[model samples]
Target: MARYFKYKSTADVMADAQSLGHELALADDLSPLFRPVTIGGRKAGNRLLVQPMEGCDGTLDGRPDELTFRRYQRFGGGGAKVIWGEATAICDEVRANTRQLLMAEHTLTGLEQMRRVTRAAHRAECGDDGDLLVGLQLTHSGRYSVRKPLLAMHDPLLDPLIVDKSTGRRVDASYSLLSDDDLKRIEDQFVVAARRAAHLGYDFIDLKQCHRYLLSELLAAKNRPGEYGGCLENRTRLIRNVIGRIRSEVPGLLIATRMNCYDGIPYRGVGEGENFIGQPCPHELPLVAAFGTNPHDHREEDLTEPLQVARDLRDWGVSLINVTLGNPYGNPHVIRPAEFPPIDGYYPPEHPLLGVLRHFRVARQIQAAVPEIPIVGSGYSWLQDFAPQAAAANIAAGHVALAGFGRATLSHPDFARTLQTEGRLNRKQVCRTFSYCTGLMRAKDHPLGQFPTGCPPFDKEVYGPIWKEVEQRT
Candidate 1:
């Protein structure tokens, strides 16, 4: 059991971070969280942003379904200034899930309607919509690509772990890696998507280069040959090129990037059969390859390259840079600070607070290095009721411009509103980091096709029956 399960107050959480050799402060007041701020040339109503947490519930033709509309409606009305939309695929085949939204000619009108719903919800809840900035994340799930996995460059770290979750068996197959010509086509598709996003009235578009996706994987492509591989410049060519075209063609929409500033190497089990699990101290040795880390010592980060990437993005005219770490597919604990592991996830190798500290410190480092650029920080969902205090402290300290939440919002979408009006969180409504959302999604898609994802066990009324059936079977 986690030590935090017994912690009862905000001070206890802060003390735990300090006892672990990491410092996290509690807010004296909630003013910092409610203060208005500006990013990418537009002013925001407050400093909180709803991080892109995808709900795999879109229609077959890539349009937002009722579930999708409800999720963003809560985000818009919940008082977060920036509603950072979830990852929507540029093309249908490259989607991460069967129901992942896609940006296309047929989906434009529906996408527009989704945005209108958000705006109306915001106006109704907050009395104004001028300060809310909504954006869409465009991505191609590289190794975890939907229907068929499309990898940029294969490596031993991630390839061997690919499994057919339905049977809990490792898949053995030689998958085709995407070529440079294929990358060029993908880049063009992104440019086209940006054009449509602009027309649909999205304030910005997050050219997502994170989470070991296609563009992010290219950043670690040291082995592949040709113009789109090798050096950092070549690796970033696709995103930079896409940005240039979007500026030339669309011009009106702003650009932002949700980038993975650091990647802790992949870890695998070192034991036998069904008992196999992640090595307890896997970071003892360096990683094979990673971004923003010493190639020789993957456990040690060398932010020189990642900092330069931030500078380049700013130079290319990006408004805000949202920072995250690790690949959730291979390294869930790093990206999300969870108490219990999901159905297919590994037991957390260390205390979950370590993951939270790593992200906080990384965001501080980036903010200090590029003081001119604005940054949105992740990993606050694990903070529970104390999230507002911790987020306020960081924002007040200038470590991060906005404190973002993912799973926390899925369970408690009214958190921001409650915090704004009541000045504290409703403890009963806060996420406990049970990771049931992830477990529910996996259960729904193990063999593919099921209910839309929300907080199944916590939200209860709508998802409780499905959770019960899943619990009975497993």
Candidate 2:
């Protein structure tokens, strides 16, 4: 719903929203960052971060491109405790787009390249004040792949993504029940890739459990009366098993998982397999939506997974918990606190301020529940002015926003540095003028034109040609 302004005072805004039963999020001191928090018993320098985002500039074989290396190198140098690798698939079939990075085949060589380069660069920069901990985010694109059609947990009900076909426009996805072997192979690949990451000097491997990915599918499998479905245990078994195997494979490395509190739908079990994009299906699987065996009912326990998963993995001595709102396209409302899309999204008034503000509200709730665990957060990162608000959510003042603006960060890799020094706040950075960064995904022909995806416009025009050269595989 659109927020109205009759020129209410800040006090009035607080009172009216409070009287209406909306919760108030506390604003904390972002400067102190975090109290000493340890993951796998190792300290994470400061509470700052470089949360996992989709970095698509890998080589054809999945290696990090030169642009990819330089991008993180600067980010690492600028200073962040942890740097999350873009979502890299465990298998070729699970990649979201044919051009996306993978764990199998060509990716190993590329990852080896990334591991060596990033570690060396990060070391040269942060030094003793911090160690750049690298975490690999393993993901499966499922039905939303920008490539040819492939199997998803649900029936192929959604239309394929529009793309210039090698011939005509080819269907960009496929759907079917993954065999036991399929599940095993993907799991094995995760272990191998995670082990490889550890071998190459990365400190951790983050298993993606949020958004509509493969593990999320298992977490959301509804009502199937089988060993792999229906009950929560059945649904989460794959994640558990994968975790166990990876624990053994990369015993010395830290393991982390990002989880969603809910898929934001009532009665929608584990996401109906996410078959469509704009409006078809969650295709073939269910997603974690609060606490019914499916999405039919919300349970308090269901909402507590971040802590529970943290505890469960803690038993295995795993690492941190990175939290985020997963739905951007399927449920923009998740990020936007409005009863409807805000006007700022259109041109001038479309920012959905209330919705974005609400993300902090959710983060605060999660923090209250698990005060001791190291939690990484997003949804309003570019609002550097929200220093106190970010601290209120328990994120350190030094923390950097993961996906704050499509291009805002590009112009300021030191976005967090500025906030740390310049010091101001803008918790409501979403002014209806901003559109979601939907245009930057795997588009063809024009890699990305004048628009910014998740960073500010590059300050150095020379960086473009340099980046293009890096993207060209050696």
Consecutive 10-residue window with the lowest summed lDDT within model 2: 339-348
Q: Per-residue lDDT of 17-118 in model 2, one digit per residue for the tens?
A: 465566444344554553344666777665556656554556655667666777666666645566677788877657665456687655677677776666
Writing each residue's lDDT as its tens digit, candidate 1 over 1-474 gives 334445778788878888898787878688999988888779999998999988877887789998899888888888888998898999988888777889988989888988898889999999999999999999888877656667777655776667534445554435567888999999999999988888899999999999998888888877667888788899889889998888888887899999988876775554554344455234433454578877677656678878888889888888899999988877788889887776667667778888888899888888887788789999998878888888999999999999999999988887888899899877877888888888766765334454467887567886677678778877
Error of 2 at 464 (Å): 8.9
Backbone-clash count (model 2):
61
- Largest TM-score belongs to which candidate? 1
How close is every model to the real structure, measured as TM-score? Answer: 0.93, 0.73
Q: Against the true structure, candidate 1 has what lDDT?
A: 0.82
Q: Ten residues in a row with the worst lDDT in model 1?
A: 276-285
Give the residue spans of candidate 2 off by over 4 A. 1-21, 25-28, 34-36, 116-125, 148-152, 155-175, 265-311, 333-354, 364-372, 382-384, 392-411, 424-437, 446-474
- Which residue runs does candidate 1 get wrong by more than 4 Å? 163-175, 268-277, 280-286, 444-450
